[model samples]
Target: MIRFENVSVTYEGADEQHQPTLREVDLTVPEGELVLLVGPSGVGKSTLLGAVSGLVPHFTGGTLTGRVTVDGRDTRTHPPRELADLVGTVGQDPSAHFVTDTVEDELAYGMESLGLAPGVMRRRVEETLDLLGLAELRDRPIATLSGGQRQRVAIGSVLTPHPKVLVLDEPTSALDPSAAEDVLAVLQRLVHDLGTTVLLAEHRLERVVQYADQVLLLPDGVMGSPAEIMTVSAVHPPVVALGRLAGWDPLPLSVRDARRRAGGLKARLEGRVPAGPDLSARPASGKQDPGPGPGHGKGLDGGDRVGRSDGTGRSGGFNPFRRRRTEAPAPAAAPLALVDALGVRRGRVEALRRIDLTVTPGETIALMGRNGAGKSTLLSTLVGMIAPTSGTVRVAGRTPHTTTPRELIRQVGLVPQEPRDLLYADTVAAECAAADADAGAEPGTCRALVSELLPGVADGIHPRDLSEGQRLALALAVVLTGRPPLLLLDEPTRGLDYAAKARLVAHLRVLAADGHAIVLATHDVELAAELAHRVVIIADGEVVADGPTAEVVVSSPAFSPQVAKILAPQPWLTVEQVEEAL
Candidate 1:
């Protein structure tokens, strides 16, 4: 349904000095086929998707050299509004896609724009609400819903119009595992039963690789079947990675297929125990164990202190000085954060109820649940954004709601669900400088973190110009500058690719070891398995399950990682663990 013939896009700012963003992209997507677009963070994947919807050169103010047509309608001549009846597009930021207040209104807005029959619109709206699991949220205002909930509403709004071609960018980035599966299943039905063409771009290949009939690797513009593309593609799912590790003939796309051929790999790793997050690494002090002070840098890298001092009593963020103490800690260490019978009410909704949780120093916790299940509510409560209707929340022994922003920076820091909320500066350099000043750290602290997390990012680039993943990395680096004793991250890996995610896991591990407490409200199961020492499952505003990562995740099929599912009953959580054992 979508065809790009010798298409190339170059923005106005580029005066032949820089190469075109999309160069010589010639491809044709067959009707009724689901094509998966895969590439690194800054590649032209989003640009390619925009070409089909006519958002690239039309609305984005770029020059288009070639032609892009959808269903016999050329995108160049037909603007987004003219093509809206035939094509539906959902971008990364779902909030930007909304034009109405309530969930039901947002879903019906598209059909109303098309001037569809009122009865037909109502029927399609109801079907979409049920299909995307937005029935309960139909009456809720879009502003009051969580990030993941907004994503579903945005998708349902496009889906209600019943367009022939659907183009999605990171459709499942904000969704939980189960909700992502449901949305992908609905897309599968559209492809198989209804014959709708879908062109999607997502970094989480493990979730969508199996659903794709054809895989399109961008920048290089390589297109082929999933097996053929994965065999040579650098960015791939864990199932394909494991197939490469075990030397399997054909890489498997799904867990079931991988499991059928995993008997031998399981046998090889039968007696070996997987290496888990090191939770015993703690400070060797008998003192009150005051949380990570400005000069306290022993926790991150095996006693490699951060923040060097030039006799000013303020050290830079990273220092090469290493100091390790072998002595053990005193008994009865205090918890970094304490939540007792926490109850939060937003309007008429009980966002959280009777929740009890604790985080000691040097521990990582993963909060897992479905969409609108109050995971973000719990994070907001802990960070002091929302006051509790009942119970108490204490971080670093101070009530978050009662603490001042200046004082709270030393005690706790939060990288909110929307990463843009934490950034306001014009340039990347300015953002880092502002973070250093706000956190009272030496210069270059935030810049160093950004370089480590997202390498090759220019200092002059504007935060708004960054890709979703690049922007997220910059936000994370800004938060880490403070060296807060208690850190909270909401969906930390939303737009990150596998390579970027590996960098994040490495950095978080160092922080956890350096005596900092971390809490992640997330839906990435593989991330939880890789970095979290404890997994807490929340459902209906209550903690249904909480235990060590392996025991909690492996028991639940929905939350299990691909390696755990492939090597069944073996307690393996990641391909790295299996590879380490062999």
Candidate 2:
């Protein structure tokens, strides 16, 4: 269905010619096959996907030295518009793909452009709406939807056209775990039931590796089965990592396969307790002694509050507000942020409601829930992007919604869902320089952070030219330059590989050790396992679950990490934890 012959691409540079992003790539993707393209950030995965849709040379203004054909049509001669009927491409940013105001119209726009019959278009639109669970949101304007909702609309729009080939770059990056599973299930149906060809590039291997028919490891452009490639690939999922740590032959791609082989390893770790990080300390609360098991001490239940008392004469029902001065045993340090009975409304929808959360110094909290379940809204509320409809939100003791930007920068910094939103400079060097000046930091401080997060990134390269992961790193560096007391990140690991994510985890740990509070809204369960001390789950704009990371995540099947799933009934949340216990 797709073929690449001696393909090499290079982009013209201003002062000096740039290196080839893709070199000597030769491959063939058969019909009805799902080919997962895996590689580290900036390793030409997106560039290769663009080439298949005829966006590299014709639209992106790059040089192509080799022949590329899709469905027996040469991509060199056929532009994106010409191949629209045969191929549908969804880029990293789903908002960029929007051409209409409402979800239903966006889904129908592609079919209308193809001049499908009215009856056919209507039927396809309804099917797509049902398939993607956009039925209730069909008439809603796309602008009001959350990032993950926009992603579903973007995908549903393409699927309505019934294209033979789908070229998706990080299709599930913005989706929550359940929504990701739904999207992947839709793709699986398309491939098996309709014989559709899918070429997808994703950084989160754990979500898609099991669904892939073949793995195409990039830069080298080597293609093989998932088991064949994961054995040597630098980028991999937690289940594969666990398989490797346990010395299991032929690494497993899915949790079920790994679970079948994890029996012996589980027995080895039966009584041994994992020496995970001790993050039981809460704001205004004294240090909590380590418990007998993982995450057992000082963990808050869903209904438990810091000082609120139940009839049993015990603190219960979590009240994420300031305690009265009359309370005994005063807090050691004030909370970095406090949200009390928070409510936010966007249009007719209630984005958040009666939500209560607190960020303590040195705490790393992970905000998790289904897509469009108010995770982003809660983050925006914390960062002061959205004003609360009711109740109060304070960051560093100052009201975030009313605080000045200049003053807010020092107390709290937010890296939004779209990393590009925080970036405006042309070149990477200029961005870093501006961040340093904005934060009043020493020279090269931001650049040094960028180098640590994203090594080997050239100073002269335009921020637009960097990969999604690279842009995120640059944005994170810009935010970290200020060294704010509280940090807010939304989907921080969207496009990052395992190695890059590890670096990010290490950096955040260092920041937490320095007494900086960190909160990230994410769908990456593995990230929560590796980094979060506490997990807060939002559902339908309310706080449904809140507790220590292990206690909260392991109880929910959808939110559990692969390692935890493989070694069930055990408190181990990561392969590293199991290894440490062993």
Candidate 3:
């Protein structure tokens, strides 16, 4: 249903230069198959997706050689609108695709644009709402919906058009585990039942690897069976990594398959126990303990001593599962930040309720909940972007709301859900230079950090032209340049592959060890498993559960990572932990 013949994409660059994003690629996506396109950051995955929907050269102002066809219609001859009936494209940012205010209306907007009959539009809208499990949210305004909900609405909107080919970029990147499964299930039904062609790109492979019919390896643009491609691919999910470590001949794609082959591996790991204190056994005390020291080599200085709740100062450690010592020693320093009785109202909606939170130095906290559970709202409030309707937020002993931008940049830096929002300069180099100048850091500091986070990204490329993962890396570099005492990142792993995520986790650990408090609003349970010292669960704008990572994630079904789920009854959280035990 989709074909790319001898295609090459080149974008305009400095000095009238042209940079090739895709080089001499030939591909064919059979009808009714779910094809997963994956590669390293900035390796032309999104560019390839854009070509299928005719956005590459036409809309993006790039030069496209050869041809791309969807459902036998040449994309070059037909613009996006002309192919709208046959092709529906949902991008990484769902908000950019929205044209209507309400969920029901958003679902109907595409059909309306296609000039469908009102009755047909109504039936399709209802069917889509049921198909994607958006029935309860049909009447809700799109602005009030959570990130995951907005993603569902975006997919449902395009689905209403009944396009033969659906093109999606990171469709489930924002969804919680259950929500991601729901979205993937809907895509599978479209492929199996209706024979619709679904092409998608996602970084969180653990969630979607099992559902793929075939894998399209980019850069080289090689296509093969999922198992075959996964064996050689670097950007694979945790399960694939685990399979590799265990020496499974054919790597298992799904958790079920992994479990079937895990018997022997499990036997090998039978008597092994994860290193660290037993989180459940550790009693809650007034004073918190300072756990393991830093692991990230170089650049980060881990010499700062954190005062324990008991008033004893100790060097930082890098244990991922360390519990936060709640009760500091009587003479200990105050928390780096505090949120007391925080309430925020956005118009008629209560975004955040009376929430109380504390962040001590050197603590890595994961703020997790269903999408729209006040996670982003809380982050915004902490950074002074959103003024709370009531309650007080203090970071570095100063009110975040009343602090100046210059001071706030040094005290607390926030990376919002859309990383592009933080990028403003023309090129990556310019952005990095600007970040250094703004943060009063030495020249090349931001660029060096970007190289550490996302290597191989050209300095001259426009920030807008970089892949989602690369943009996030640049944004993160920009934020870290200030060396803020507190860091707030919302859904930071949206487009990062496994390797990128690993780098981020390591850097975060180093940051935590260096006495910087980190709070992340994310749907990535696996990240929480690997990096968070404390897991804070929010629901309906209230803190439902707050405890050490193990206590919180292992107790909840929706929040547990794959390793935790596989090795249930055991306190393991990652492949590295499993490896360490054996």
Q: Each candidate: what lDDT? A: 0.80, 0.82, 0.79
lDDT of 2 at 469: 94
Write the residue-wise lDDT of candidate 2 on 469-522 in tens digits. 999888888888878888888898988888888888888876776678889989
lDDT of 3 by residue, 1-582 (tens): 888899998887721345588989998899999999888877888889999998888898878999898888998999988888899999988888998889998998888888899999889988998888788777787777777888889999988988999999999898877778889998999999999999999988888878899999988788998999998898888788888988988888877787788888777778776665222322233345433112342343111101000000111112233223344454244677889999887766677787988887767789987766688888888887777789899888888778877667777888887778788889999988888888778888888888888888888888887778889888888888877888888888888887778887777777776668889989999888887878888776777777777778888888888877776776777888887667
Candidate 1 lDDT over residue span 98-142, tens digit each: 999999999999999999999999999999989998887788778
C-alpha lDDT of candidate 3 relative to the true structure: 0.79
Question: Candidate 3 regions off by >4 Å?
Answer: 14-19, 277-331
- What is the number of residue pairs that collide in model 3? 12
CA lDDT, candidate 3, residue 409: 70
lDDT of candidate 1 at residue 471, scale 0 to 100: 89
Candidate maximizing lDDT: 2
Provide the global lDDT of candidate 1 against the true structure: 0.80
Question: Lowest-scoring 10 consecutive residues by lDDT in candidate 2?
Answer: 303-312
* Alpha-carbon shift of residue 168 in model 3 (angstroms): 0.5
Off-target runs (Cα >4 Å) in candidate 2 are 14-17, 278-330
* TM-score list, all predictions: 0.91, 0.92, 0.91
